[model samples]
Target: MAVNLPLPIPENLTAVAGIELGHAEAGIRKADRKDLLVMKLAPTATVAGVFTKNRFCAAPVQLCKEHLAGLRPGAPIRALVVNTGNANAGTGESGLAKAKETCAALADLLGCAPTQILPFSTGVILEPLPVDRLVAGLPKAISNLKTDNWHNAALSIMTTDTQPKAASSKVTINGQTITLTGISKGAGMIKPNMATMLGFLATDAKVAQPVLDRLVKDVADRSFNCITIDGDTSTNDSFIVIATGTAAVEVNAIDTPEYKALFAAVQALAQALAQMIVRDGEGATKFITVTVEEGRNVEECRKIAYSIAHSPLVKTAFFASDPNLGRILAAIGYAGVDDLDVTQLNLYLDDVWVAKNGGRNPDYQEADGQRVMKQSEITIRVRLGRGDAVSTIWTCDLSHEYVTINADYRS
Candidate 1:
């Protein structure tokens, strides 16, 4: 059961003007499943991406950075190949070779340079990518390419995700309507330093490559970077944004109205996708939002927020819907904010004041705390009487099913 997550409707997923997507049953790690996806981009399209900071990042991630660095102004990214169920990570030299081979295979079929193609993989770590099966399926994916295949593309990227995560929005900039649609897949090993899992967002709006690069980092900071699940970052996390340059409006200036509108739309879509990852977290039964405020700086607030969000004690209490709210305080105390003053802190579950001035509030009731905990969606707010900085993170409650899921993950 995936908390309150629901599959996205195919009809509502609009297609970007210069992007075509397709998927195939590659039989890479599983039988009768769509585990391969290929995306073809227009010659005018430009791409920007942010990858995981994990030291042991997948081979595809390293290759993606190298390939993106080789991107020049006129030579746009031609194709993107992705495979699920075998993260090309921890295989060392062999993994790098396989990732390059996958790119070369796709580039050969597309008649483009190997450096023009970006490769991505996700799933079990320390496993070799079955490049043979993946390469054999490229022709079928190419044959199936279509502009309206976003729904199937989303489904094809799944690893342990119970449902496909996707979102779409339209923004009018300078009288031109630009469509932004994206899909993300993540269920566990999530705690993204840059992005939780694999996310690809495409738009038809024209933007300069430099601006696009800056925009991706900004968008990720406010969206994908704000989410976490289980506090373990994956080796294959990637968030990529593509600008197809099909819209009539050109977003060259950050100060322009068009740029602001486009940025907001993209950030909103990314946030929606990030939240979906938490809602669909493996065996998750509750969605939690931890908000920390009045810190000396945004970084400190984020540390405190993550401390609470990542605490197994706090998450288990959320799972049981128990009023053992003190665990949240314990997390805050140990959050490494050396100067944090407990006497000036306040805690609330939704609107109910759970703690004040470093102790249980006199008016706080266990029933009220339990009431908020029982809800499928919950907000835990903490206010520190310091500065004005604040940070919020999305996560899910720890449950027995989470343990069971990971225990049998390889099976």
Candidate 2:
């Protein structure tokens, strides 16, 4: 079961204008399941994205980057094709060919150049994608393309997710209302540097390509990059933003108030989706948030936060509801901040101040820590009496089910 997360309601997922989605039962790995998705965009839409930083990035990621670089004023990405159940990574040149072939097939059907299409894949890494089945399903996906298919689109890209992750909201900027809808998927092999997740946000706002490009990165850092599942980054991680110029509001610069308003909406939706991944983390029974504050810089704070969030010992302690508070202090000490002053550190679990100035608080009791640890959701606050910087990372406790899931994944 996924911690405290609830299933997404389909009717509540509003569709962004100028984008149509369709899904098909490709049966790439499983029978009678949605394994293919197609997102058709308007000709006026502009696209931007941030991909995984892993050196062994998947073939589709490399192809998507190439297609994005080829964007120009007259030519824009017309469609995006996604497949689940096979990552299309580590097949060397053959994998690259298969990815391109998938795009070419979809492009032919859409009457657009192959370069105008972006392809994405997820699931069993190193295994060759069942491209034949995926290609055969494109017609079915295209035949059903509808603007209100966001719900089905979310379900098509899922792998280990217990439920489809999707959200929608409307923001008014200068009297013009912009609708943003997004979907994401991931349950394990998630970490920073794109977070091993696939996220796509589409808005009915007019945004210049350059500005949209920068906005995706900014939203990703504050959202997806602030989460970790197993401290492992997948090779196919990607977060893309699509702006269809159907709304009256036009944004071409980053310094305007309209830009800030748009950014807030995108960031909020992205964070909600990102946190869902952690909440549904493989074998996760507890959702944990680690916030590091009072650091000399944001980088150091994030480092400390990630260190504690990624500590298996600390996570296991939380899973067992054991008040093993020292594990957290140890994680912060070796967080690569070589000059960090341990004497100035503090730790807290919810409202219980467990440590004061790097030592166990005299007034603290083990029962108080246990009480917080037993909760379904927890927050671990770390204070470094250094400066005024803070960063928070979301994660989930490690459990026996996580090991079993991975061990039997290929079977």
Candidate 3:
């Protein structure tokens, strides 16, 4: 079961002005299920994305990079198509050709060049994509496109997610209102090397391509990149940010106050969406926040935070509501901080001071630890006492159901 996660209210999911979304039941992997999504963009929109760093990336991921990299100032991305149930990864040349063919098919429907469309896929890897079914679903998806389909778009791209993840917020800058709405999906095979899931955020603000590109990477690093579930990155991890240029708030450079405001608003929404993915992680019962503070740099802080988050022993202990916190210390020790001084370290489980200065806090009790561990939401705070740097990562406890889910995933 998901931990403290709720379905997003459809009425609250405001739509961006320049993007229209539609979904279709393609039955790519299962019968009568929403498995395809098309997002048609206004001509004025500019798109930017960051994809998985896995060497064996999916064909669609490669195509997206090529399409975005090949963008001319006048010819921005026109549309995005996402299909669930089959990740076209590790299929070599033929898969690449099929992905290209899919793009061509969509471009023909939209009366645009094949390169103007960015393609995305997520699901079981190493299997040939059923391109004919996905292609056949395109017209139906495009036919139902609407500006207010963010909620259904969220559901259409889901693979292992227990529920759709979507969020919306509005931020005003210079008298112009910017609305940001986004959706993300992933339940397992997560640990974003670049990002182990799919995230699409669209805003009606006007932004230069260069600025949007920078924002996407920065937003992703602080959001999707700071999460882990099972520590396994996918071949099709992607996070895309779209700027429709419909609103009067124009940001052309990264140095402006407008850009700062936009980044904050987008970051907050992205964080919310990314956290939802962890909260709904496969069989997750607890949403865990691993925070490492007072580090020499952000890198070291993140390394230690990820170490704690990815520790199976610690995760299982969290699942069992067991305060076997020694596993946490062990994880921190092996986190590659060679010059770390354990004597100065302090650890807290929520409000309970479990460890003080590298030793068990005298006032700490087993009951106190268990109290926090048993909660659906828990925070693991580690004060490194090294410097001013801090980093936090969201994760979920490893449960037996997670194992069962994966063991029979393709069956």
Candidate 4:
């Protein structure tokens, strides 16, 4: 059971023009399950991506970076190959060889250069990818490609996610309506400094490669990078954006109205996907948002927000619906802000003021805190009475099911 998360409604997903997706049942780690996904892009599509900062990133991640760098001005990405059940990380030379071979195989079938194909993998780390199974499954995925397969594509890339994560939106740019659709998969190991997760977004509006590169980083910083689960970064985190120049709209300048609308729509979709990941977190019962305001800088505010979000004590209190203000205060105090003034800080759970001036509020009531804590979703707001900086992080409450899920993950 996935806490309060609901299965995504398939009818709500809009298909992006110039993109086709398909899935196949590959026995990579399990038999008779859809574990492989292939996404085909139009030849005019330009792509950009952000990857995990973890030094032990998967072999596919390394290959994706290399391929993206080798892309020529006129040669755009043609295909994306994804597999679940084996992460293909920490397998040394063989893992790199397998990842490359997969790309070569995909490119051969699609009649494009190997660098035009991007390969992605997610599952257990430190495991060798079953290349034979993946290669054999490619033809079926390629043969079944269709423009309206976003729903199944979301399901195919999932590892432990209880439900598929997908979002879509349409915006008018230059008197033309452009469609944007995206899907993400993750359940745990989700502190992204790029998640053990994969996100793919595609838009039909025309965009330059350099602009796409900058847009991906900026959107990710405001979306995927603002979430945490268990405070562990994965070895296979990847978020990719594709612009298929199929629409009549062209966004060549970043300072134009078209760019702002496109950026806002994409960022909102990404944030929705990111929030879904936390809501479906393994053994999570409550979705939590930690907001830190009035700091000297955004970085310091983010530090304090994450400090509170990643605290096991605070998470446990959230799980139990216990108003343990001391734990939250402790996390904020040790958040490495040397100049923080305890007396000038305030804490609130939803609309109830729980703490003021480094202690409990005189008018605070336990019942009020309990009422907000009992909800499936809650927000923690902290005021620092400093500058105007603010930061918000989305997280989930820790529970025993989290331990159980990871303890027997391999079995």
lDDT string, candidate 2, 206-292, tens digits:
999989999999999999999998999999999999999999999999999999999999999999999999999999999999999
Q: Give the Cα-based TM-score of candidate 1 against the true structure.
A: 0.99
Q: How far is 16's C-alpha from truth in model 4 (Å)?
A: 0.9
What is the alpha-carbon lDDT of model 3 when measured against the actual structure? 0.94
User: Please, what is the whole-model Cα lDDT of each candidate in the order they appear?
Assistant: 0.92, 0.94, 0.94, 0.92
Instruction: Give the winner by lDDT: 2 or 4.
Output: 2
- Badly placed stretches (over 4 Å) of model 2 are none
Q: Rank the candidates by lDDT, best first.
A: 2, 3, 4, 1
Superposition error at 357 for model 4 (Å): 2.0
Q: Using Cα atoms with residue i matched to residue i, what is each candidate's TM-score against the true structure?
A: 0.99, 0.99, 0.99, 0.99
Q: After superposition, how far is residue 88 of candidate 2 from its true place, in Å?
A: 0.2
Writing each residue's lDDT as its tens digit, candidate 3 over 1-411 gives 678888888999998999999999988999899999999999999999999999999999999999999999677799999999999999999989999999999999999999999999999999999999999999999999999999999999898889999999999899878999999999998896665589999999999999999999999999999999999988999999999999999999999999999999999999999999999899899999999999999999999999999999999999999999989999999999999999999999999999999989999999999999999999999999989999999999999999999999999
User: When superposed on Cα atoms, how far off is each prediction in RMSD?
Assistant: 0.9, 0.7, 0.8, 0.9
- For model 1, the local distance difference test gives 0.92
Local error of candidate 2 at residue 137 (angstroms): 0.4
